[model samples]
Target: MNILITNDDGVYADGIFELANKVKAIANVYVVAPDSEKSAIGHAITIHNPLMVKKVNFRNTDIDAYAVSGTPADCVKLGIEAILEDIHIDLVLSGINNGPNLGTDVIYSGTVSGAMEGLVQNKPSIAISYDGKNISSKEYEKGAEYVVQFIDKIKDNLTMLDDTMININIPDIRDTKINGFKVTQLGIRRYENTFEKRIDPRGNIYYWLGGKTVELEQDENSDVTAIKNGFIAITPLKYDLTHYDRIGRIMKEIQPLDI
Candidate 1:
């Protein structure tokens, strides 16, 4: 099997390197990622700017790698469409992310967007993240190992429908023993945002965005709840955002205007 790996954390990040190292033992691995961190960039493709890709000598690994001057989504799209066009990719894996991408916060996550892009191209994809706010290289290695184990176990039996991808969140392994895996849904996650106004050296006013996550009551079968309980959260996500059930009701409520 051939697997293509990409991440918003960039091609040089320890998380991606460790992940590629482990996965290469199981299958052919190709690494294509952003040159710099593109966190929270979502599923944006670079259209205005010309995307420049450079061949990278990815650390101690022999895996074929490239660093793209674009978003995470662009890396996958370019990898499939241009870079690795001749290679038949069996799966796409995004991340062993430095931080958690849980709940609705995934809406802004470039990590998730990388996998989503692969799914858009009709490939089975997965996004894996470690629930650690401040993590070390060792922690990233542990996360990568766990993800590889999980992938190895499910590679043969995994079946996904069209327009769907798997989002996996691993609990922090520093102090917690992983109980198991829980297949769950995306939970509500909100943040209390703060914009701090500051004066620059030249007396220019600037504002920096910062926020803390707001705690909320979550369902038992939610990704957030599972991660809190020391379980790996595995949520199957769909790219389609249309509310199918509401379409009929909305159409019925509004009368058609005749011109």
Candidate 2:
């Protein structure tokens, strides 16, 4: 199997490197990711500025790796279209991310976006994340190991529909035993946003975006709920944003309107 791995955390992050090392044992791994952190960048692409790429030695792994001066989506796009164009990528895996990408936050996740980009190119893709917000860095290897095992288990039976992507979130398992995998749906994850206004040394005003997660009632089968109960959450996602059920109702209501 040939796997292309990318992450929102920069090329130097331990999560990506550890994942690459573990996955290389089972597949031909290739790493293409941002040169610097682009967390929560969503599906943004670098169009206005020229994208710069450089080959990098990725730790103890011998896999081909590149650092891109762009977002996670750009890294995957460039890797497929330009960097590794001659290669047939069997799977595109994103993350083993530095933090959790749970519930509604996936909409703003660059890690998830990286995998979604692979789906856009007609490749099987998955995004895996660890609950690292409160965990130690030493635990990343364990998370990587779990991800590799999951991939190995599904590698033979993996069949991705054209419009779908797989998203996985691993809870912080340092203190708790894993409750195994749960196929789940996205849950509500609203944030109480805070924008602190501040002045620069030169007296210019600026706002720094910051927020804490707002606790809300979640469904029993939600990704958030699974994580809270110590399970690995797997959610299948599609890029289609159309409200199909509403379309017919809206058309019926508007059909009598003259141009």
Residue-by-residue lDDT tens digits, candidate 2, 115-174:
999999988899999985655556777888888878877887777445689899998877
How close to the true structure is residue 18 of candidate 2, measured as C-alpha lDDT? 82
TM-score of each: 0.95, 0.95
Best by lDDT: 1
**Model 1 C-alpha lDDT per residue in residues 1-259, reported as the tens digit of each score:** 8999999999999889888988898999999999999999999999999999999998856899999999989999999999999999988999989888988989999999999998999988999998886888888887887888888777886565356899999999987889988999999899899999999999999999999999999999999999999999999998889999999998888868455
Q: What are the Cα lDDT values of the candidates?
A: 0.91, 0.90
| CA error at residue 112 for candidate 1, angstroms | 0.3
Residue 184's lDDT in candidate 2: 95
Clashing pairs in 1: none
Worst lDDT 10-window in candidate 2: 132-141
